[model samples]
Target: MKTAINTAVKTRTLPLAIADFKQITKAGLAFSVVFSSIAGYLLGADQIDLTVLLLLSVGGYFMVGASNAFNQVIEKDLDALMKRTRKRPVPSGRMSVPTALTIASVFTVLGVVTLYVVNPKTAMFGAISIFMYVCMYTPLKTRTPLAVFVGAFPGAIPFMLGWVAATNDFGIEPGTLFMIQFFWQFPHFWAIGWMLDDDYKRAGFKMLPTDKKDTATIIQIIMYTFWMILASVFPVTGLTGTLTLSVPAAVIVFILGLGMLLFAFKLYNNRSNRSARQLMLASVSYITLMQIVYVVDKFL
Candidate 1:
Protein backbone atom coordinates (compact mmCIF):
# COMPACT_ATOMS: atom_id res chain seq x y z
CA MET A 1 0.00 0.00 0.00
CA LYS A 2 2.80 2.43 0.84
CA THR A 3 4.57 1.83 -2.42
CA ALA A 4 1.31 2.20 -4.38
CA ILE A 5 0.57 5.50 -2.63
CA ASN A 6 4.04 6.79 -3.42
CA THR A 7 3.62 5.90 -7.09
CA ALA A 8 0.27 7.67 -7.25
CA VAL A 9 1.68 10.79 -5.65
CA LYS A 10 4.59 10.82 -8.04
CA THR A 11 2.26 10.48 -11.02
CA ARG A 12 0.09 13.31 -9.78
CA THR A 13 3.02 15.62 -9.10
CA LEU A 14 4.67 15.06 -12.47
CA PRO A 15 2.13 17.23 -14.25
CA LEU A 16 2.61 19.98 -11.71
CA ALA A 17 6.32 19.97 -12.37
CA ILE A 18 5.65 20.25 -16.09
CA ALA A 19 3.28 23.10 -15.50
CA ASP A 20 5.79 24.81 -13.26
CA PHE A 21 8.46 24.48 -15.90
CA LYS A 22 6.20 26.09 -18.49
CA GLN A 23 5.16 28.90 -16.20
CA ILE A 24 8.66 29.60 -15.01
CA THR A 25 10.41 29.52 -18.38
CA LYS A 26 7.54 30.90 -20.48
CA ALA A 27 8.18 28.79 -23.56
CA GLY A 28 6.29 31.22 -25.76
CA LEU A 29 8.59 34.07 -24.78
CA ALA A 30 11.59 31.82 -25.22
CA PHE A 31 10.45 31.05 -28.78
CA SER A 32 10.56 34.74 -29.64
CA VAL A 33 14.06 34.99 -28.23
CA VAL A 34 15.16 32.01 -30.26
CA PHE A 35 13.71 33.38 -33.46
CA SER A 36 15.20 36.83 -32.94
CA SER A 37 18.54 35.27 -32.14
CA ILE A 38 18.39 33.41 -35.43
CA ALA A 39 17.70 36.68 -37.23
CA GLY A 40 20.72 38.21 -35.53
CA TYR A 41 22.81 35.28 -36.51
CA LEU A 42 21.76 35.61 -40.12
CA LEU A 43 22.50 39.31 -40.17
CA GLY A 44 25.87 39.03 -38.45
CA ALA A 45 27.39 35.81 -39.76
CA ASP A 46 28.44 35.37 -43.38
CA GLN A 47 28.55 31.62 -42.88
CA ILE A 48 26.74 29.83 -40.09
CA ASP A 49 28.12 26.90 -38.15
CA LEU A 50 25.53 24.41 -36.94
CA THR A 51 27.48 23.76 -33.77
CA VAL A 52 27.55 27.43 -32.80
CA LEU A 53 23.88 27.74 -33.69
CA LEU A 54 23.03 24.83 -31.42
CA LEU A 55 25.03 26.29 -28.57
CA LEU A 56 23.33 29.69 -29.00
CA SER A 57 19.89 28.10 -28.92
CA VAL A 58 20.70 26.16 -25.76
CA GLY A 59 22.32 29.13 -24.08
CA GLY A 60 19.40 31.41 -24.93
CA TYR A 61 16.88 28.96 -23.53
CA PHE A 62 18.84 28.59 -20.31
CA MET A 63 19.14 32.33 -19.81
CA VAL A 64 15.44 32.95 -20.43
CA GLY A 65 14.41 29.93 -18.35
CA ALA A 66 16.49 31.06 -15.40
CA SER A 67 15.03 34.57 -15.51
CA ASN A 68 11.51 33.21 -15.58
CA ALA A 69 12.13 30.75 -12.76
CA PHE A 70 13.54 33.47 -10.54
CA ASN A 71 10.58 35.66 -11.43
CA GLN A 72 8.18 33.00 -10.14
CA VAL A 73 10.12 32.60 -6.96
CA ILE A 74 10.01 36.33 -6.30
CA GLU A 75 6.38 36.79 -7.26
CA LYS A 76 5.01 33.67 -5.61
CA ASP A 77 3.17 35.61 -2.91
CA LEU A 78 1.68 38.25 -5.16
CA ASP A 79 0.82 35.58 -7.71
CA ALA A 80 -1.63 33.96 -5.32
CA LEU A 81 -3.71 37.13 -5.24
CA MET A 82 -4.06 37.41 -9.02
CA LYS A 83 -6.85 35.51 -10.71
CA ARG A 84 -4.78 34.81 -13.81
CA THR A 85 -1.83 33.52 -11.77
CA ARG A 86 -3.26 32.00 -8.62
CA LYS A 87 -2.91 28.37 -9.69
CA ARG A 88 0.81 28.59 -10.52
CA PRO A 89 3.06 26.03 -8.88
CA VAL A 90 4.73 28.32 -6.39
CA PRO A 91 1.49 29.94 -5.32
CA SER A 92 -0.42 26.65 -5.09
CA GLY A 93 2.29 25.00 -2.97
CA ARG A 94 2.88 22.42 -5.67
CA MET A 95 6.57 23.35 -5.66
CA SER A 96 8.65 24.39 -2.72
CA VAL A 97 10.21 27.84 -2.90
CA PRO A 98 13.61 26.48 -2.00
CA THR A 99 13.40 23.90 -4.77
CA ALA A 100 12.42 26.58 -7.26
CA LEU A 101 15.30 28.74 -6.13
CA THR A 102 17.71 25.87 -6.54
CA ILE A 103 16.50 25.22 -10.06
CA ALA A 104 16.80 28.90 -10.94
CA SER A 105 20.35 29.13 -9.61
CA VAL A 106 21.48 26.06 -11.44
CA PHE A 107 19.94 27.15 -14.71
CA THR A 108 21.49 30.61 -14.40
CA VAL A 109 24.96 29.28 -13.73
CA LEU A 110 24.79 26.62 -16.40
CA GLY A 111 23.35 29.04 -18.93
CA VAL A 112 26.13 31.53 -18.39
CA VAL A 113 28.75 28.80 -18.63
CA THR A 114 27.26 27.57 -21.89
CA LEU A 115 27.31 31.04 -23.37
CA TYR A 116 30.86 31.55 -22.14
CA VAL A 117 31.89 28.52 -24.10
CA VAL A 118 30.29 30.06 -27.17
CA ASN A 119 31.87 33.51 -26.54
CA PRO A 120 32.68 35.54 -23.45
CA LYS A 121 30.80 38.61 -24.70
CA THR A 122 27.67 36.53 -25.31
CA ALA A 123 27.93 35.12 -21.80
CA MET A 124 28.44 38.56 -20.24
CA PHE A 125 25.37 40.06 -21.92
CA GLY A 126 23.32 36.97 -21.05
CA ALA A 127 24.20 37.33 -17.40
CA ILE A 128 23.41 41.04 -17.50
CA SER A 129 20.05 40.43 -19.15
CA ILE A 130 19.11 37.86 -16.53
CA PHE A 131 20.17 40.14 -13.71
CA MET A 132 18.14 43.07 -15.02
CA TYR A 133 15.10 40.91 -15.60
CA VAL A 134 14.93 38.90 -12.37
CA CYS A 135 16.69 41.24 -10.00
CA MET A 136 15.32 44.55 -11.31
CA TYR A 137 12.25 44.08 -13.50
CA THR A 138 10.56 41.42 -11.34
CA PRO A 139 10.71 43.58 -8.25
CA LEU A 140 9.71 46.77 -10.06
CA LYS A 141 6.49 45.24 -11.40
CA THR A 142 4.76 45.72 -8.06
CA ARG A 143 6.27 49.06 -7.20
CA THR A 144 5.87 51.17 -10.34
CA PRO A 145 4.76 51.25 -13.94
CA LEU A 146 8.32 52.01 -15.03
CA ALA A 147 9.01 48.31 -14.66
CA VAL A 148 7.81 47.74 -18.19
CA PHE A 149 10.42 50.12 -19.59
CA VAL A 150 13.08 48.58 -17.38
CA GLY A 151 12.06 45.10 -18.43
CA ALA A 152 12.34 46.10 -22.09
CA PHE A 153 16.07 46.51 -21.63
CA PRO A 154 16.61 42.83 -20.97
CA GLY A 155 13.83 41.80 -23.31
CA ALA A 156 15.59 43.55 -26.17
CA ILE A 157 18.94 41.93 -25.49
CA PRO A 158 18.34 38.51 -27.08
CA PHE A 159 18.46 39.84 -30.62
CA MET A 160 21.71 41.60 -29.84
CA LEU A 161 22.95 38.54 -28.02
CA GLY A 162 22.53 36.64 -31.25
CA TRP A 163 24.64 39.21 -33.06
CA VAL A 164 27.34 39.06 -30.42
CA ALA A 165 27.27 35.29 -30.56
CA ALA A 166 27.88 35.45 -34.29
CA THR A 167 30.36 38.32 -34.58
CA ASN A 168 31.69 38.06 -31.04
CA ASP A 169 31.50 41.83 -30.81
CA PHE A 170 29.02 44.68 -30.29
CA GLY A 171 28.43 47.19 -33.06
CA ILE A 172 25.83 49.06 -35.10
CA GLU A 173 24.30 45.80 -36.32
CA PRO A 174 23.36 44.57 -32.86
CA GLY A 175 22.40 48.10 -31.84
CA THR A 176 19.73 48.22 -34.53
CA LEU A 177 18.34 44.85 -33.43
CA PHE A 178 18.20 46.08 -29.86
CA MET A 179 16.39 49.28 -30.86
CA ILE A 180 13.79 47.41 -32.91
CA GLN A 181 12.85 45.09 -30.06
CA PHE A 182 12.99 47.84 -27.47
CA PHE A 183 10.44 49.90 -29.37
CA TRP A 184 8.25 46.87 -30.03
CA GLN A 185 7.66 46.02 -26.38
CA PHE A 186 5.72 49.13 -25.37
CA PRO A 187 2.74 48.44 -27.57
CA HIS A 188 2.94 44.71 -27.08
CA PHE A 189 2.86 44.93 -23.29
CA TRP A 190 0.43 47.82 -23.14
CA ALA A 191 -2.07 45.79 -25.11
CA ILE A 192 -1.59 42.98 -22.60
CA GLY A 193 -2.08 45.45 -19.77
CA TRP A 194 -5.24 46.68 -21.41
CA MET A 195 -6.55 43.15 -21.85
CA LEU A 196 -5.83 42.12 -18.27
CA ASP A 197 -6.41 45.46 -16.59
CA ASP A 198 -8.89 44.19 -14.06
CA ASP A 199 -6.89 41.10 -13.15
CA TYR A 200 -3.73 43.13 -12.75
CA LYS A 201 -5.54 45.65 -10.62
CA ARG A 202 -6.66 42.91 -8.25
CA ALA A 203 -3.03 41.93 -7.75
CA GLY A 204 -1.85 45.54 -7.20
CA PHE A 205 0.23 45.51 -10.38
CA LYS A 206 0.58 49.02 -11.82
CA MET A 207 1.02 47.97 -15.38
CA LEU A 208 -1.31 50.32 -17.09
CA PRO A 209 -0.08 53.83 -17.62
CA THR A 210 -0.67 55.72 -14.40
CA ASP A 211 -3.47 53.23 -13.71
CA LYS A 212 -5.57 55.21 -16.14
CA LYS A 213 -7.28 53.99 -19.30
CA ASP A 214 -7.41 57.49 -20.65
CA THR A 215 -6.24 59.05 -23.87
CA ALA A 216 -2.67 59.20 -22.59
CA THR A 217 -2.26 55.44 -22.41
CA ILE A 218 -4.00 54.89 -25.70
CA ILE A 219 -1.95 57.60 -27.34
CA GLN A 220 1.19 56.07 -25.96
CA ILE A 221 0.29 52.72 -27.50
CA ILE A 222 -0.43 54.32 -30.84
CA MET A 223 2.82 56.27 -30.77
CA TYR A 224 4.87 53.25 -29.85
CA THR A 225 3.11 51.19 -32.50
CA PHE A 226 4.06 53.82 -35.03
CA TRP A 227 7.66 53.76 -33.85
CA MET A 228 7.71 49.98 -33.97
CA ILE A 229 6.59 50.10 -37.57
CA LEU A 230 9.31 52.60 -38.40
CA ALA A 231 11.99 50.62 -36.64
CA SER A 232 10.90 47.44 -38.38
CA VAL A 233 11.26 49.14 -41.75
CA PHE A 234 14.42 51.05 -41.00
CA PRO A 235 16.74 48.14 -41.68
CA VAL A 236 15.15 47.61 -45.07
CA THR A 237 15.72 51.26 -45.97
CA GLY A 238 19.51 50.74 -45.79
CA LEU A 239 19.65 53.38 -43.06
CA THR A 240 21.08 50.83 -40.63
CA GLY A 241 23.79 49.92 -43.23
CA THR A 242 24.78 46.53 -41.78
CA LEU A 243 21.36 44.92 -42.30
CA THR A 244 19.25 45.72 -45.34
CA LEU A 245 16.15 43.88 -46.50
CA SER A 246 15.35 43.33 -50.16
CA VAL A 247 12.59 45.39 -51.77
CA PRO A 248 10.17 42.47 -51.79
CA ALA A 249 11.04 41.64 -48.23
CA ALA A 250 10.53 45.25 -47.24
CA VAL A 251 7.05 45.26 -48.77
CA ILE A 252 5.97 42.14 -46.92
CA VAL A 253 7.27 43.46 -43.63
CA PHE A 254 5.43 46.75 -44.18
CA ILE A 255 2.16 44.92 -44.76
CA LEU A 256 2.63 42.92 -41.60
CA GLY A 257 3.30 46.04 -39.58
CA LEU A 258 0.28 47.73 -41.08
CA GLY A 259 -1.92 44.81 -40.11
CA MET A 260 -0.71 45.04 -36.52
CA LEU A 261 -1.12 48.82 -36.55
CA LEU A 262 -4.72 48.51 -37.61
CA PHE A 263 -5.39 46.40 -34.53
CA ALA A 264 -3.50 48.88 -32.35
CA PHE A 265 -5.72 51.64 -33.71
CA LYS A 266 -8.80 49.55 -33.00
CA LEU A 267 -7.74 49.11 -29.39
CA TYR A 268 -7.01 52.79 -29.08
CA ASN A 269 -10.32 53.83 -30.58
CA ASN A 270 -12.52 51.33 -28.75
CA ARG A 271 -10.58 50.65 -25.57
CA SER A 272 -12.72 47.54 -25.16
CA ASN A 273 -11.56 44.18 -23.94
CA ARG A 274 -12.32 42.63 -27.31
CA SER A 275 -10.24 45.24 -29.10
CA ALA A 276 -7.43 44.79 -26.59
CA ARG A 277 -7.50 41.02 -27.08
CA GLN A 278 -7.40 41.48 -30.83
CA LEU A 279 -4.42 43.80 -30.52
CA MET A 280 -2.70 41.26 -28.31
CA LEU A 281 -3.21 38.55 -30.91
CA ALA A 282 -2.17 40.88 -33.69
CA SER A 283 0.98 41.80 -31.84
CA VAL A 284 1.85 38.14 -31.42
CA SER A 285 1.25 37.42 -35.08
CA TYR A 286 3.21 40.48 -36.11
CA ILE A 287 6.34 39.45 -34.25
CA THR A 288 6.18 35.84 -35.41
CA LEU A 289 5.60 36.83 -39.00
CA MET A 290 8.33 39.43 -38.86
CA GLN A 291 10.80 36.81 -37.71
CA ILE A 292 9.68 34.45 -40.46
CA VAL A 293 10.03 37.16 -43.07
CA TYR A 294 13.52 37.95 -41.88
CA VAL A 295 14.59 34.32 -42.17
CA VAL A 296 12.85 33.85 -45.51
CA ASP A 297 14.31 37.03 -46.94
CA LYS A 298 17.78 35.84 -46.02
CA PHE A 299 17.39 32.57 -47.86
CA LEU A 300 15.59 34.03 -50.85
Candidate 2:
Protein backbone atom coordinates (compact mmCIF):
# COMPACT_ATOMS: atom_id res chain seq x y z
CA MET A 1 0.00 0.00 0.00
CA LYS A 2 2.89 2.39 0.79
CA THR A 3 4.56 1.74 -2.58
CA ALA A 4 1.29 2.13 -4.47
CA ILE A 5 0.56 5.43 -2.75
CA ASN A 6 4.03 6.71 -3.58
CA THR A 7 3.60 5.71 -7.20
CA ALA A 8 0.28 7.52 -7.47
CA VAL A 9 1.69 10.62 -5.82
CA LYS A 10 4.63 10.69 -8.17
CA THR A 11 2.37 10.26 -11.19
CA ARG A 12 0.17 13.16 -10.08
CA THR A 13 3.05 15.42 -9.10
CA LEU A 14 5.09 14.94 -12.29
CA PRO A 15 2.56 16.36 -14.73
CA LEU A 16 1.65 19.12 -12.35
CA ALA A 17 5.26 20.12 -12.09
CA ILE A 18 5.62 20.12 -15.85
CA ALA A 19 2.50 22.22 -16.22
CA ASP A 20 3.75 24.71 -13.68
CA PHE A 21 7.08 24.99 -15.47
CA LYS A 22 5.30 25.65 -18.73
CA GLN A 23 3.18 28.32 -17.12
CA ILE A 24 6.17 30.07 -15.61
CA THR A 25 8.12 29.91 -18.85
CA LYS A 26 5.25 30.89 -21.19
CA ALA A 27 6.39 28.01 -23.35
CA GLY A 28 4.35 28.80 -26.46
CA LEU A 29 5.66 32.38 -26.64
CA ALA A 30 9.21 31.14 -26.02
CA PHE A 31 8.84 28.70 -28.92
CA SER A 32 7.71 31.50 -31.20
CA VAL A 33 10.75 33.57 -30.19
CA VAL A 34 12.95 30.55 -30.96
CA PHE A 35 11.34 30.22 -34.35
CA SER A 36 12.32 33.80 -35.21
CA SER A 37 15.89 33.12 -34.13
CA ILE A 38 16.06 29.98 -36.25
CA ALA A 39 14.69 31.80 -39.26
CA GLY A 40 17.34 34.48 -38.87
CA TYR A 41 20.02 31.80 -38.47
CA LEU A 42 18.97 30.05 -41.66
CA LEU A 43 19.06 33.31 -43.56
CA GLY A 44 22.51 34.37 -42.36
CA ALA A 45 24.36 31.04 -42.33
CA ASP A 46 26.31 30.16 -45.42
CA GLN A 47 26.65 26.63 -44.16
CA ILE A 48 24.62 25.25 -41.29
CA ASP A 49 26.29 23.57 -38.35
CA LEU A 50 23.87 21.43 -36.41
CA THR A 51 25.91 21.94 -33.25
CA VAL A 52 25.57 25.71 -33.29
CA LEU A 53 21.92 25.37 -34.23
CA LEU A 54 21.30 23.18 -31.22
CA LEU A 55 23.13 25.58 -28.96
CA LEU A 56 21.14 28.58 -30.24
CA SER A 57 17.85 26.75 -29.81
CA VAL A 58 18.63 25.70 -26.25
CA GLY A 59 20.26 28.94 -25.22
CA GLY A 60 17.62 31.12 -26.83
CA TYR A 61 14.85 29.29 -25.01
CA PHE A 62 16.71 29.59 -21.73
CA MET A 63 17.06 33.35 -22.14
CA VAL A 64 13.40 33.86 -22.99
CA GLY A 65 12.23 31.51 -20.26
CA ALA A 66 14.36 33.31 -17.74
CA SER A 67 12.93 36.66 -18.78
CA ASN A 68 9.40 35.32 -18.41
CA ALA A 69 10.16 33.72 -15.04
CA PHE A 70 11.60 36.95 -13.72
CA ASN A 71 8.67 38.92 -15.12
CA GLN A 72 6.28 36.60 -13.32
CA VAL A 73 8.19 37.02 -10.08
CA ILE A 74 8.02 40.78 -10.40
CA GLU A 75 4.39 40.84 -11.46
CA LYS A 76 2.94 38.10 -9.30
CA ASP A 77 0.65 40.44 -7.38
CA LEU A 78 -0.51 42.29 -10.44
CA ASP A 79 -0.88 39.02 -12.32
CA ALA A 80 -3.23 37.70 -9.65
CA LEU A 81 -5.55 40.66 -10.23
CA MET A 82 -5.77 40.10 -13.97
CA LYS A 83 -8.19 37.41 -15.08
CA ARG A 84 -6.08 36.44 -18.09
CA THR A 85 -2.99 35.94 -15.93
CA ARG A 86 -4.54 34.87 -12.65
CA LYS A 87 -3.89 31.19 -13.29
CA ARG A 88 -0.17 31.53 -13.93
CA PRO A 89 2.16 29.55 -11.70
CA VAL A 90 3.22 32.22 -9.22
CA PRO A 91 -0.06 34.09 -9.33
CA SER A 92 -2.07 30.93 -8.81
CA GLY A 93 0.12 29.80 -5.87
CA ARG A 94 1.24 26.68 -7.69
CA MET A 95 4.83 27.99 -7.60
CA SER A 96 6.73 30.14 -5.14
CA VAL A 97 8.66 33.34 -5.87
CA PRO A 98 11.92 31.91 -4.58
CA THR A 99 11.52 28.89 -6.79
CA ALA A 100 10.78 31.06 -9.80
CA LEU A 101 13.73 33.33 -9.06
CA THR A 102 16.06 30.35 -8.67
CA ILE A 103 14.83 28.95 -11.98
CA ALA A 104 15.37 32.31 -13.63
CA SER A 105 18.89 32.65 -12.27
CA VAL A 106 19.78 29.16 -13.40
CA PHE A 107 18.32 29.78 -16.83
CA THR A 108 20.20 33.09 -17.14
CA VAL A 109 23.55 31.44 -16.39
CA LEU A 110 22.86 28.48 -18.65
CA GLY A 111 21.56 30.65 -21.46
CA VAL A 112 24.54 33.01 -21.40
CA VAL A 113 27.10 30.19 -21.19
CA THR A 114 25.46 28.26 -24.01
CA LEU A 115 25.31 31.35 -26.17
CA TYR A 116 28.90 32.19 -25.26
CA VAL A 117 29.89 28.84 -26.66
CA VAL A 118 28.47 29.99 -29.98
CA ASN A 119 30.31 33.33 -29.81
CA PRO A 120 31.01 36.11 -27.32
CA LYS A 121 28.79 38.50 -29.25
CA THR A 122 25.90 36.06 -29.17
CA ALA A 123 26.20 35.74 -25.40
CA MET A 124 26.45 39.51 -24.98
CA PHE A 125 23.31 40.15 -27.02
CA GLY A 126 21.44 37.37 -25.24
CA ALA A 127 22.27 38.87 -21.87
CA ILE A 128 21.20 42.30 -23.08
CA SER A 129 17.91 40.92 -24.28
CA ILE A 130 17.19 39.43 -20.87
CA PHE A 131 18.13 42.66 -19.09
CA MET A 132 15.96 44.78 -21.32
CA TYR A 133 13.00 42.47 -20.97
CA VAL A 134 13.10 41.94 -17.23
CA CYS A 135 14.66 45.12 -15.90
CA MET A 136 13.30 47.69 -18.33
CA TYR A 137 10.19 46.38 -20.05
CA THR A 138 8.62 44.60 -17.08
CA PRO A 139 8.87 47.62 -14.81
CA LEU A 140 7.83 50.03 -17.49
CA LYS A 141 4.64 48.14 -18.33
CA THR A 142 2.69 49.47 -15.37
CA ARG A 143 4.11 52.96 -15.68
CA THR A 144 3.80 54.00 -19.30
CA PRO A 145 2.05 53.18 -22.51
CA LEU A 146 5.43 53.54 -24.24
CA ALA A 147 6.37 50.26 -22.60
CA VAL A 148 5.42 48.61 -25.85
CA PHE A 149 8.06 50.61 -27.67
CA VAL A 150 10.67 49.84 -25.02
CA GLY A 151 9.71 46.17 -25.11
CA ALA A 152 10.22 46.12 -28.85
CA PHE A 153 13.97 46.44 -28.45
CA PRO A 154 14.47 43.12 -26.71
CA GLY A 155 11.72 41.57 -28.76
CA ALA A 156 13.64 42.50 -31.93
CA ILE A 157 16.92 41.02 -30.71
CA PRO A 158 16.27 37.33 -31.33
CA PHE A 159 16.18 37.69 -35.09
CA MET A 160 19.35 39.74 -35.12
CA LEU A 161 20.93 37.61 -32.40
CA GLY A 162 20.56 34.55 -34.58
CA TRP A 163 22.22 36.40 -37.41
CA VAL A 164 25.07 37.42 -35.13
CA ALA A 165 25.28 33.83 -33.91
CA ALA A 166 25.63 32.63 -37.48
CA THR A 167 27.84 35.38 -38.87
CA ASN A 168 29.36 36.62 -35.64
CA ASP A 169 29.02 40.07 -37.09
CA PHE A 170 26.47 42.91 -36.92
CA GLY A 171 25.71 44.94 -39.99
CA ILE A 172 23.03 46.06 -42.40
CA GLU A 173 21.73 42.49 -42.75
CA PRO A 174 21.06 41.97 -39.06
CA GLY A 175 19.88 45.56 -38.73
CA THR A 176 17.30 45.02 -41.45
CA LEU A 177 16.15 41.80 -39.82
CA PHE A 178 15.93 43.66 -36.52
CA MET A 179 13.94 46.50 -38.08
CA ILE A 180 11.45 44.15 -39.66
CA GLN A 181 10.64 42.51 -36.35
CA PHE A 182 10.82 45.79 -34.47
CA PHE A 183 8.11 47.28 -36.59
CA TRP A 184 6.06 44.11 -36.51
CA GLN A 185 5.71 44.11 -32.72
CA PHE A 186 3.70 47.35 -32.50
CA PRO A 187 0.79 46.07 -34.53
CA HIS A 188 1.00 42.58 -33.09
CA PHE A 189 1.10 43.65 -29.46
CA TRP A 190 -1.30 46.56 -29.83
CA ALA A 191 -3.92 44.21 -31.16
CA ILE A 192 -3.32 42.04 -28.10
CA GLY A 193 -3.46 45.12 -25.89
CA TRP A 194 -6.76 46.07 -27.46
CA MET A 195 -8.24 42.66 -26.83
CA LEU A 196 -7.07 42.59 -23.25
CA ASP A 197 -7.55 46.26 -22.40
CA ASP A 198 -9.88 45.49 -19.52
CA ASP A 199 -7.70 42.76 -18.14
CA TYR A 200 -4.66 45.00 -18.52
CA LYS A 201 -6.42 47.88 -16.77
CA ARG A 202 -7.17 45.56 -13.87
CA ALA A 203 -3.41 45.06 -13.45
CA GLY A 204 -2.60 48.76 -13.95
CA PHE A 205 -0.84 47.95 -17.17
CA LYS A 206 -0.54 50.80 -19.67
CA MET A 207 -0.74 48.73 -22.81
CA LEU A 208 -2.79 50.68 -25.29
CA PRO A 209 -1.54 53.83 -26.95
CA THR A 210 -4.07 56.08 -25.26
CA ASP A 211 -5.23 53.79 -22.44
CA LYS A 212 -8.59 53.39 -24.13
CA LYS A 213 -10.08 51.57 -27.11
CA ASP A 214 -10.66 54.73 -29.13
CA THR A 215 -10.21 55.84 -32.72
CA ALA A 216 -6.77 57.25 -31.99
CA THR A 217 -5.57 53.83 -30.82
CA ILE A 218 -6.97 52.02 -33.82
CA ILE A 219 -5.50 54.62 -36.14
CA GLN A 220 -2.11 54.10 -34.55
CA ILE A 221 -2.48 50.36 -34.98
CA ILE A 222 -3.29 50.86 -38.64
CA MET A 223 -0.36 53.21 -39.03
CA TYR A 224 2.07 50.73 -37.50
CA THR A 225 0.73 47.96 -39.65
CA PHE A 226 1.68 50.05 -42.66
CA TRP A 227 5.18 50.56 -41.30
CA MET A 228 5.53 46.87 -40.58
CA ILE A 229 4.48 46.08 -44.11
CA LEU A 230 7.03 48.52 -45.47
CA ALA A 231 9.74 47.05 -43.30
CA SER A 232 8.87 43.58 -44.53
CA VAL A 233 9.81 44.61 -48.04
CA PHE A 234 13.02 46.44 -47.14
CA PRO A 235 15.10 43.47 -48.24
CA VAL A 236 13.86 43.78 -51.78
CA THR A 237 15.17 47.32 -51.92
CA GLY A 238 18.74 46.07 -52.58
CA LEU A 239 20.13 47.82 -49.51
CA THR A 240 20.00 44.99 -46.98
CA GLY A 241 23.19 43.18 -48.02
CA THR A 242 22.81 39.42 -48.30
CA LEU A 243 19.25 39.43 -47.01
CA THR A 244 17.72 39.88 -50.43
CA LEU A 245 14.10 39.19 -51.31
CA SER A 246 13.09 37.96 -54.73
CA VAL A 247 10.40 39.78 -56.73
CA PRO A 248 7.93 36.91 -56.44
CA ALA A 249 8.59 36.56 -52.72
CA ALA A 250 8.16 40.29 -52.36
CA VAL A 251 4.79 40.07 -54.08
CA ILE A 252 3.69 37.27 -51.79
CA VAL A 253 4.93 39.20 -48.78
CA PHE A 254 3.02 42.25 -49.98
CA ILE A 255 -0.11 40.18 -50.34
CA LEU A 256 0.35 38.86 -46.81
CA GLY A 257 0.82 42.40 -45.60
CA LEU A 258 -2.37 43.43 -47.33
CA GLY A 259 -4.20 40.65 -45.50
CA MET A 260 -2.97 41.98 -42.16
CA LEU A 261 -3.90 45.49 -43.24
CA LEU A 262 -7.36 44.22 -44.05
CA PHE A 263 -7.73 42.92 -40.53
CA ALA A 264 -6.52 46.21 -39.13
CA PHE A 265 -9.18 47.98 -41.15
CA LYS A 266 -11.79 45.57 -39.87
CA LEU A 267 -10.77 46.44 -36.34
CA TYR A 268 -11.11 50.10 -37.22
CA ASN A 269 -14.51 49.57 -38.76
CA ASN A 270 -16.00 47.47 -35.96
CA ARG A 271 -13.79 48.26 -32.95
CA SER A 272 -15.00 45.13 -31.17
CA ASN A 273 -13.10 42.54 -29.18
CA ARG A 274 -13.73 40.05 -31.97
CA SER A 275 -12.17 42.38 -34.52
CA ALA A 276 -9.17 42.94 -32.24
CA ARG A 277 -8.81 39.19 -31.81
CA GLN A 278 -8.94 38.65 -35.55
CA LEU A 279 -6.33 41.34 -36.10
CA MET A 280 -4.13 39.73 -33.47
CA LEU A 281 -4.35 36.32 -35.14
CA ALA A 282 -3.72 37.85 -38.54
CA SER A 283 -0.63 39.64 -37.27
CA VAL A 284 0.78 36.39 -35.88
CA SER A 285 0.07 34.53 -39.10
CA TYR A 286 1.57 37.39 -41.09
CA ILE A 287 4.87 37.32 -39.23
CA THR A 288 5.22 33.54 -39.20
CA LEU A 289 4.33 33.16 -42.86
CA MET A 290 6.58 36.06 -43.85
CA GLN A 291 9.50 34.48 -42.03
CA ILE A 292 8.85 31.17 -43.75
CA VAL A 293 8.64 32.90 -47.09
CA TYR A 294 11.88 34.76 -46.44
CA VAL A 295 13.70 31.52 -45.52
CA VAL A 296 12.27 29.56 -48.42
CA ASP A 297 13.07 32.30 -50.89
CA LYS A 298 16.67 32.39 -49.70
CA PHE A 299 17.10 28.64 -50.11
CA LEU A 300 15.10 28.13 -53.30
Best by lDDT: 2
TM-score for each predicted model, relative to the true structure: 0.95, 0.99
Clashing residue pairs found in predicted model 1: none
Clashes of 1: 0
**Off by more than 4 A, model 2:** none
lDDT of 2: 0.94
Model 1, residue 56: C-alpha shift (Å): 1.0
